[model samples]
Target: MTAIYSIFGRISETIEKLAAIHRLLPWILAFALLLPLPQILSALFNDYYIYLANKICIFILLSVGLNIVKGFCGQVTVGHVGLYAIGAVSSALISLHFGWSFWLAFPIGILAAGLAGIVVGLPSVRLEGAYLALATLGLGESVRIMIAVTPLFGSSTGLLSIPAPTIGSFTFDSYTNYYYLVLAAAMIGIYLSFSILRSATGRAFMAVREDTVAAAVHGVNVTKYKLLAFVISALYAGAAGGLFAHMPPGYIHHNNFTIIEMVTLLLMIVLGGIGHIWGGIIGAIIVTIIYDQTLEFYFYQPLLFGLTMVLIVIFMPRGIGGMIDRYLATKKFIASQEEKSNAAS
Candidate 1:
């Protein structure tokens, strides 16, 4: 174990050194690798994998946003899927009924979701824990129920033939073409998330999460930061929803944004690490891939997922991200011990 930890520590140190050499080196490398993913998937497997990749990107946005409110701000919001539904339906309706372009509808969809976030966050000022979770869960279910029953939302038939995004004569209707659009948005969302997480607002969010009363005592407006977190998260969900609505063969239904979907999002964050920065991204990718792979076991899928969550909670409460952090910490400790021993010699 000692030898293995030493080796891993050396490797991690080398990577850290490389990353430190350029401010954007990790990002540049990530993009360079990710940019070719669609092509690689298309060649190695099929366009179906590309579609899965696109879904992963969308879920990445959703998971990241959820992490902001749940992990960072300590807000227990289960209505994020509802916001996603609102964004999808709003964008689809605007394009289909109002004859507006996707560009116009997308922002409107995001705004509508942001407003909904404010409505959802309003209750958080008075509620906590289970009460807050129940409130948000009810809110989320209500959104789905409304879409299921309302004619304007296409009821059970769902909205179909939603227009694909276009720039001049170029329509992003193909899997590979649309992948670029989603990829760009996902990357921007991640970059912005990092930016916000490093700012004063992010510090406020962490403070609020750690202890609301202490944060308040320190002059942090807990209510303001909590609401801001929700709104920001809603924006990310809205954008993801809009993108999903405008993707190739654009169609969305009430069933698409159900409690099951919410659970999946929860699983993503849990698997990644509740408060870890990369938790959402890592969780989204892993969950999506596992889901795709387990399609054949549809009946048992939920059971497996539930079991996995339970095990993770019991055995690895901090999650995969936490595990990685521990590994890195162990490696650093080993390296420092070696350095101290060498100096003594």
Candidate 2:
């Protein structure tokens, strides 16, 4: 454990030094390095792995956004899937009905979800704890029910044949081709998440999360920050939805957004470590892979997921990311002690 922490500490220091050269330098290099991921996945495993990668990327976006509200702002929202549904359905409908390109429809879908986020967040002003959870859950379930019953929203049929993005003659209509589009979005989403977490807005959110009354006392405008967290989180969900809707095969059903799905998302953040910066990213990758691998045990999947969440809460309440954070903090403190001892000598 100490060795692992040392390795991570060294790597983190390297990254900080690189970041110091230019704020975006590390991210730019990361983007460039990730550009060939699709080809590499295809080479090592198979084309199906590329599809899984795309799914993971989308989940990354969703989980990260969910973290902003549920983790950062300490708002218990289960209706994030509803915002996701709005984005996917909105984008799909625009492409199917108005014949808009993915480029245009994507942002529109995101906008629609962002608007819905305000509605979902409204209850937070007066609610807390389980009551807030129930309100968000109700709102989320209502969206799924509306989609399931309404023929215009595709109902049981679902929306299909959503167009892929294109750049002139180049069409991102294949899994390999579509990987770049989603990968870029996921990367940008992560970068922005980190940016938000480090900004004054993020501190205000943390203040609100840590203590709503205290935040208000400090002139934090707790209500506004709470709402802003949801809005920002919704934007990420919306972007994820748009991408998922337009992915190859381009079909979206009401079943895609459900209580089970919301639970899975919650598991991601919980397993990764809620409020930790890399929690969503780690949880998304691990859970997505685990879920994909356990597809054959469909009957037991939910049970397995539920059991895993419970176990994690009991044994590792802080999660893998939290453990890592502790290790890093410990390593830093030890180094400082050594430095002081040497100076005393």
Instruction: Give lDDT for model 2.
Output: 0.92
Off by over 4 Å in 2: none
Please give the RMSD of candidate 2 to the true structure. Answer: 1.1
Q: Which candidate is the best by TM-score?
A: 2
Clashing pairs for predicted structure model 1, backbone only: none
Minimum summed lDDT over a 10-residue window in model 2 is located at 2-11
The TM-scores, one per candidate, come to: 0.93, 0.98
Worst ten-residue run, lDDT, model 1? 1-10
Q: Which lDDT values do the candidates have, in the order given?
A: 0.90, 0.92
**Using lDDT as the measure, which candidate wins?**
2
Q: Write the per-residue lDDT of candidate 2 for residues 80-102, one digit (tens) a residue.
A: 99999999999999999999888
lDDT value, candidate 1, whole model: 0.90
Q: After superposition, how far is residue 202 of candidate 2 from its true place, in Å?
A: 0.3
